[model samples]
Target: MFLHSRHLSRRVAIASATALLTGGAAAGAAWATTAAAAPAGPRTCTVSDLYVSMGRKEGAAGSLYWPIRFTNTGTTGCALRGYPGVSVLDAAQHRMGAAATRTGGAVSTVTLAPAHSASAVIRTTNGPVGGPCQATGTYLRVYPPASRTAVLVPAGWKVCSGTFRVAPVTR
Candidate 1:
């Protein structure tokens, strides 16, 4: 038996679309591992377990808010001096702002309990165009220095980045 030409073309198109969808789903899952629940900040040492969530505030133009959580995954305690700041870039990767604040405040130290998580907020004064980040990348600096100097949260520590998305709030 022979199949019609139209049917054969349709089958090929469906297969290609399916493969693209599958690849996209896998990429999303891999990125999720980059951010995870953590155990606060370590004391007396430098350990990092930081997670950052990005979103836009209502009526806040050119601004992005970062709900940041820094935790200690190690056995010892560590001191977290500064939170990773926000960097907004345009389509051409031009630096719009650097090290933007997640929230307005002065945080010197935060001690994390074993197997616990500490949370903070960091925001940008000069923001991304259209009230949403053109591109959002978070950075964390380890105090007392750590085995690794700094971690760009989006690059994915073990796997792909957690979730770098535009969470728009409607009404």
Candidate 2:
């Protein structure tokens, strides 16, 4: 009789442990599903949400390279994908040269938290490569991708090549 009681007690303990473990596992799975169902990431960056600027100037082999930067000024996180529209503008806001041609390259989405930035490479000839270059541009009009608004950055440089090439935006 004592042996029977001991065996029965052991079976009860095992059953209780199994039930607790199964309940805990089910609770954990429910929590995981709830967490995964949360909302998606923030929206794409607009021109108003970004503060545009020209980064450091670099020269190599008679070409000038500048990083066109877009900094997120808003409090929320945002994404920038693809190329930005670039054009040199005269003092009267007229287009000085043709719009910058897209420099073919791998483009990936860049996500920026508040105060973060992304950049694109801008290339131009170091000097007049062709003949009869005229009209100095006083500003660079930058249009962020998918945005209707544009930002003007002071250029204060002569565009001797009358052409600009811009690489895709990247982190």
* Lowest lDDT block of 10, candidate 1: 155-164
lDDT of 2 by residue, 1-171 (tens): 579657656665565566588875455544444455455567889987999999998889978888899999999999998988989899898888688899868888899999999999888788888744557678989999777789999976455566578899988
Candidate 2's C-alpha runs over 4 A off are 1-40
Local distance difference test, each candidate: 0.40, 0.81
lDDT of 1: 0.40
Model 1 off-target regions past 4 Å? 1-63, 85-97, 101-103, 125-148, 155-171
Q: Against the true structure, what is every candidate's RMSD?
A: 21.4, 13.8
Question: Across residues 92-169, which tens digit of lDDT does each residue of candidate 1 receive?
Answer: 434444433333345455565545455444434343333443344233332222234443343111101121222111
Candidate 1 TM-score to native: 0.38
